[model samples]
Structures are given as C-alpha cells and as structure tokens.
Target: MGILDDAFLKSLWVFHLATGSCNNCDIEILDCLTPRHDIERFGMLLTGSIKHADVLLVTGAVNRQCIPRIKRLYEQMPQPRLVVAIGECALSRGVFIHSYNCPLPLDHVIPVDVYIPGCPPRPEAIIAGLVKLIDQRKAQTGQAKV
Candidate 1:
C-alpha cells in the first residue's frame, strides 16, 4: 500500500456494507452521521459507490452468499483502501458463527484493517476507531502528529 497523504486522510470517503446483520450495528453506524455526532467534522463522508471509497465499514457476519459479492467489492475499491470490521458479528460472526449460512468471518473474506467490537458499537466508539485509523496512516507516512 502506498502512503496516504494528509489531504486524503482528512477527507476519507467511506462505504458501508451489511452482509446479513441484525441492523443494530447499522443503526449505530447511521447514528454517527447524525447532527449530534457530526462525524463529518473528522472529514468522513459516506459514499454510495465503493469505487470512490477510501474506507469500507463492514458490518455483519459473512454468509455464503455474501462472499463472492464482498470479494468483488473489495477488488473494486481504489488502492490505499481500508476495511473496518464493525461489531461482533463482522469480527467473529457473533452468535451466527455456527450457522450454516455464515461460513466465514469478515477477515477471511477481505483484509480488515480495524476492528470495533460490540453487539452494537456506539457512535463515539466508531469515531474513535476511525480517528485511530487516520493516526495510523500518519505514523506510516512518518508524519508528525498534529
């Protein structure tokens, strides 16, 4: 992966995908966009297309049907992209680990760069995770912390 410059890191475009979640995590994800949280302050904006995304926020367990689709999406994402496994479901398939449909954890399908664990992680946690992601990029580029 190439180094991500400060400008790109400051205005990351994110795409959210739900494989087969219960919608709880998705709800919290949306909550981050609400006025109270104002995730935009961090320069993160949601994108409708994965091709334009700098980060992918994946929620839910990876069911058999979602594997191919996820692979396709991951392949389509632009270079220097990041994947974040949000919620317990995406991290380990949660309670669905034993389910026949959920055959793989998210990491097995796509390279996950960050993990936010919770039944439904709060907006604050999501923001913190993303901020850490930006900081990590800064460190990688040998850019001093602001």
Candidate 2:
C-alpha cells in the first residue's frame, strides 16, 4: 500500500466541535488524550482545521445559532469522513433537549456514523469508539485493519 493508503488505515485526524454544553464532555474528550487513554497508540490526532480532519468528533447538543457553523465545518472536511457524536448532549441533547435554544438532533445536521453515549463518557469509551471507526473504515476500504 502507498503512504496515503497507510495513513488512512492507521491515522484518523479529528476535528472537535462544540455547539453548547456545560464543558464536561469537552473535558472528557481532552482526557482521552492523556496518559491513561493515550489515543495516539491507535494513531488518532486532534486537528485544528476541519480541512485536515478525517473524522468529526462533536460534543454538545445542536444549538440554533451554531447549526450553520457546524454544518459548514462538516462540509469543509474531505470525502469518506466519519462523524462520532460523543456524550449524551451530542447524542440526544442530554439535559438540553428541551432547551429553547436547542435546534435538532445531530443527524438532522450531519450524518453521524457512531455515537458514544454518556453524560460524559469515560476515556476508554471514547478511544473504543475511535477504534471501532477505524475498523469500520478499514472494512469498507478492504484495507488491513490496524
């Protein structure tokens, strides 16, 4: 396999987006990168720009004002991108589901491939979700699962 294909198989550059939340989920996501989790063992990276991202790791419920921004960010990512909605807020809006500011489910905005369900999921759960995504992508592309 070429370098591009190898990169695709082993690495998944992530772009994180927050609509509106209490920041618990965000901190949990950050924790996933710490020594206990060490997501880099599976070649995951947090990217600053959506353009360089291979997966979208979104937290928080979809808010009315942030809909456009989120949609735009998803659009900016290249093809064959996957989306992982972490935490209950991103999954079902959590406690914010009935908030007047809440817009719609994440699926309403962008197609979500996998969902990590929890008020704030553990680091292991987050890494597991990412590994699942990598395996799924490898299967889809007929590449050797890393």
Candidate 3:
C-alpha cells in the first residue's frame, strides 16, 4: 500500500560498472540484456547514468584505481538504490585476490545488497538474483507475497 510497495518493483533501472574485470562478466551482463534473456521484459533497463538508476550492477574486482570512481558513482544514484555485485571477482576478487592492483571486494568499497557469484554468472543466474533482490525490497516495504 506504500509507495515502496510492488510499484517500486514495476520498473528497475540499472547502471553497470566494471572496475577491473576481464570482460567475461561484462559479456554475461550483455547477455542478460539481449533478446535471449530480455531482462527488459521484467521492466529492468540498463541506464546510461547512475542518477536515473535504481540498481547498480557492478562487475569485476574493486581495484585501487577505481575505488574513488565507484564510490562516486554509488553516491550519484538516487535514494532507495540497490547494489548488486555480479561475479566472483566482485564478490571476493576471485583470481585477482592476490593481484597487487586489487584493493578490496565490491562491498568493501560500497554496500552490496545482493551478490551473484561465478567466474561469470550465467544470464539465468543474473536474472534470478535480480528477482531475489526485488523480492527482498518488497518484503522490506511490507509488500511481500502471501
């Protein structure tokens, strides 16, 4: 019944950020947008600017160089925003954990609402994770399904 109810889940605009990825996770994100997955069908859209986004889809590890930029982007987004860290790299730095350039995981840089783990999680997994996040939002706003 509130403004943050199911209405909020009707359309979720997302902004994608790649800190220091190998492009594998990026490609999978593209796959989610393609006709095959068609995430837009669920009212999920990839926006050009973080200011217009409801969710921040971050791919790749958080490196020293990208820390400030990523934090800035997170700050630019409007309130009631969600951050979904996609990929093993974003989750725990994966193979780059020992890399000198890798400074922290995505959450360490900014708060992460959900995490999709994989070298590069499949499109299906990405969609599922997003849905879960939406559901979590619904619950938090007292719009949970019966």
Candidate 4:
C-alpha cells in the first residue's frame, strides 16, 4: 500500500439497515462478531448510525413502503460509502419476490458494492464477501494487494 493509502486504512464502521426481513440475515450478521467469527479482528465494526459508517450492510427485500426510506438512508451515508447486499432477499427479493409489496431488489434502491448471497448466508460466507469488498476498495484507490 502507498503512504496515502496506509494513512487512510483503518477499522471499517458498518451500519445495518433492514428494509423488511425475517431477521435471519440479521442474526447471521451478528454471528460474524461472535467469538468464532471474530470479524472485529479484521477491523470491521457494526455501528448504530449510518453517518459514522464506511460500509452499509443492507438486509431484507425492498418493499414499496421502505423504498423512500432506503433512498434516504443511502443518501445519508458519507461519501465513498460501500453497500453490501446481505441475503437472498436483498439480492433478489427471495420469497417476497412474488409479493406485490416487494417490487424491487436492493440494487435498484442503491449501488451495491458486494453481494453476499444465501437465503441467510453463513457468517463465513459473509466474511469472505467482506474480504472481497475490502480488496476491491484497495484496487479502486490504486493500492497494492493487501
């Protein structure tokens, strides 16, 4: 990594936004922080507010009611914010695809940086996807391999 890149690299503060989910993905997200996963060891943190986050982990299908809120939240995030579509629902609306209320996937609401796919992806899968996101960020900024 270059000097400029090294100066900026640090713990990533993540914010979780739930459109409307069964909470399966939410649970798995939490699992990532537990003893077994130890995601924090990699410098990822879950923050309660979007303003403080470098990354946003979006869960659930995009229901009509939540569309406006989603856009607002996306807009609220700081510049260079990354969005991760967490779970099958956020990726494709999952079981809610057939419902009239869930008209669009998360990407339609905001740009997705990385997608962690699974009905409720295991914590391990989520971690892998996050690593990819981090590497992508490095590449985007012209940094050497981490």
Whichever of 2 and 4 has more TM-score, that candidate is 4
Please give each candidate's TM-score.
0.95, 0.92, 0.95, 0.93
| Model 1 worst lDDT window (10 residues) | 1-10
Candidate 4, residues 29-80, lDDT tens digits: the string is 9999999998998898899988988888999998899999989988999876
Q: How far is candidate 1 from the true structure (C-alpha RMSD, Å)?
A: 1.7
How does each model score on lDDT?
Answer: 0.90, 0.84, 0.90, 0.88
Off by over 4 Å in 2: 1-6
* Candidate 3 per-residue C-alpha lDDT over 1-146 given as tens digits, one digit per residue, 9 for 90 to 100: 67655666899999999999999999999999999999999899999998889999999988999999998998888888899999999999999999999978888889999999998899999999999998888777777642
Per-residue alpha-carbon lDDT of candidate 1 for residues 11-109, written as tens digits (9 for 90 to 100): 999999999999999989899999999899888898999988999999998888989999999999988889999999999999998999998899988
**Model 4 regions more than 4 Å off:** 1-8
Q: Which has the higher lDDT value, candidate number 2 or candidate number 3?
A: 3
* lDDT of the structure predicted as candidate 4: 0.88
TM-score of 3: 0.95
Per-residue error at 135 for model 4, in Å? 0.5
Q: After superposition, how far is residue 56 of candidate 4 from its true place, in Å?
A: 0.7
| Model 3: lDDT of residue 20 | 91
Clashes of each: 0, 0, 0, 0
